[model samples]
Target: MKWFEIALVVLTLGSGLVLLLDKLFLAKRRATKGGLLDSEEPALVDYSRAFFPVLAVVLVLRSFIAEPYKIPSSSMMPNLLIGDFILVNKFAYGIRLPITNTKVIPTGEPRRGDVVVFQFPGHPDMPGDPQRGENFIKRVIGLPGDRIGFHGDTLSINGQPLAYEVKGEYVGKGRGAEMNGATLLSEALPGRTHTVLEYLGRANPAGQGDWQVPQGQYLVMGDNRDNSDDGRFWGFLPEQNLRGKAFLIWLNCSGWFCKDGFEPSRIGSGIQ
Candidate 1:
């Protein structure tokens, strides 16, 4: 579901909770009192007293503090695997209203190497779009003025190669399938570090269009380089499209080894 839809659902649930609490607690007191029991009065007052305040609190916290998201793909692979439930710092990019998603505070811009969650630019109606019904999580590889290119599977930003080192193989889990001929490597992005996959002997088109990231826009890519359909295919992410910077991996729900169990190692770990 979209973020707005989820926020609506949450608001509705909170409203319901408040009404239930009022009926169970306050209605009996009013009934025992000498006041005439107006049938509609209890429901109206209960709902009004309960819903708005709770809803407002949640809206403020989620909009300005932090919001949670689940990783649904291997596009971030070694850094963030499928089923990783993470928290995003909403105020990192700026404060935006929950349902409307309009920024109200100018906190900061997305820096290079920051892992970001963004609204997918891929056309939702396109038949072959992998981003359909999904929010994409990727690392910011290139910024507004950076010239980005890839040759022989090596990423170059502003005519300089980002640091890369070979890590071990990534064993696939459950439906966490790997590409037929892909190898995982540890990649370093300026000050941030993560992992990327390289598809050797794969005939991938090199030297994509020279993107001059327009002002208030950023270029993003998956850490799992070869497997990601990122800014390379879809257009750049506008500043308004940014949700937040992903910071923590709170849970991994892959049904690989434990169908209903949690991965202890991933819990409470920070996202790079």
Candidate 2:
């Protein structure tokens, strides 16, 4: 969560400042002619010393190495189900500062067919925007400057249609049962092939169109074609909004409480 990251950074920095201040001035006052003060160390200083290292390590790992995120919707279904806890490679794209999301190092760029998490481009900075700063995951369909088009449940990139092999109807379970009857097909993209769900005879007028992707942007869509609110509904995803590439499913459990919905088979599977 954004708030979680912010709070972690604040706590780590605050504790570090306290430690620095103590080492510079407070520690001298605590020392006496007998080599130590009669009173014990302040509770605040003790807490700062105890928690600073743990907080600092967590902040560095979560912000630069990898971060865990839970699936909250069925948009990327069949591949990423609701309740799946995935680990996103924070440095997969680049090294970005926490909270500000400013890129400090150029590591790599997203390839077509990569499952990426990004900030929702729903006017996130505008006040009163409910979806502000929200994270959304989808598959990259078109790279910058690529000619992308979608019509009749088919995707075309650079004037060539992506090959699709029907894999039959998808029988979803748990919270994804509603998508059970959706048509399943294995779509072949460059460097990878993944399954996609399409509803025959269903129309998505707003999402069906052709466009030329601009530079520093990407065209993305969900595997659940008919149901996803993705680049088709919005526009090209800004490069600055890119969070990271989701590569693994670490855990999966349905519902708010950890009740009877655990999909063990999906655990440790890499996202294709």
Candidate 3:
């Protein structure tokens, strides 16, 4: 479990214990006229009791409503930037028990073209253990039972070529300057259109045929096509591994991840 979650649990439990002990002490003092008078000891209930309600609300909101995540990679660059702090709607996919990640309430299923946060399948960090909380953000390319293909740098789905509009050479700003001359383009999915980067000089690695997504699984890829380690490298994403849908960028502290120190313009924009 994350340290924040552990702290929240500890705080909630500590608050409850304080309240219970306070009630018990009050009852004991009431039974006797001078039972452990105030002169004998400090207040049994700590100030934590005063913050119980606030802490509980924060815990619930973070666990079941929305949770904050930091983008650690540039897989979804141009849409999500490294060092960008985003809010993932926890209940967007389903109401799963926090920490354990076992889904108990069905909210909604992910659709094609939706940028989502999910546990990367077979990723070393994403073990069978749910407590690891390993997650990756990427665009849903092929839904379950759908066929997706990539020819050279072109994408085709179900035997039809996807429309790709060239958007000139990309000029990288931070660590992304590594791809300063990569080709930029716009890709239109079924329900959404988003910008993408393609390094035309990179050779395809054993990628000539279609990808057959299995049942209860999805095929995801990054917007930074050539640099991404996605479905092509890790295989399909299991449905049960979904975390939530990434919807908003709440803050941006470029820090060591980017050459820019802070990007104020990215905040408040919806993740497309």
**Which pairs of residues collide in candidate 1?**
none
TM-score per candidate, chains pooled: 0.78, 0.95, 0.85
**Least accurate stretch of 10 residues (summed lDDT) in model 2?**
32-41
lDDT of 1 by residue, 59-166 (tens): 667667887887877778767777788999989988886655689888899888899987776753487776654667888887887777766767777777877776
Model 1 residue runs over 4 Å out of place are: 3-40, 124-134, 172-181, 206-210, 255-261
* Superior candidate under TM-score, 1 versus 2: 2
Ten-residue stretch with the least lDDT total in model 3: 37-46
How would the candidate models be sorted by TM-score, starting from the highest?
A: 2, 3, 1
Tens digit of per-residue lDDT, candidate 3, span 73-159: 888876777788999998988898766678999999899988888765675555674523467889999998888998888888888
Better-scoring candidate (lDDT), 1 or 2: 2
What is the lDDT for 28 in model 3?
74
lDDT of the candidates, in the order given: 0.74, 0.90, 0.80
Query: Which candidate number maximizes lDDT?
Result: 2
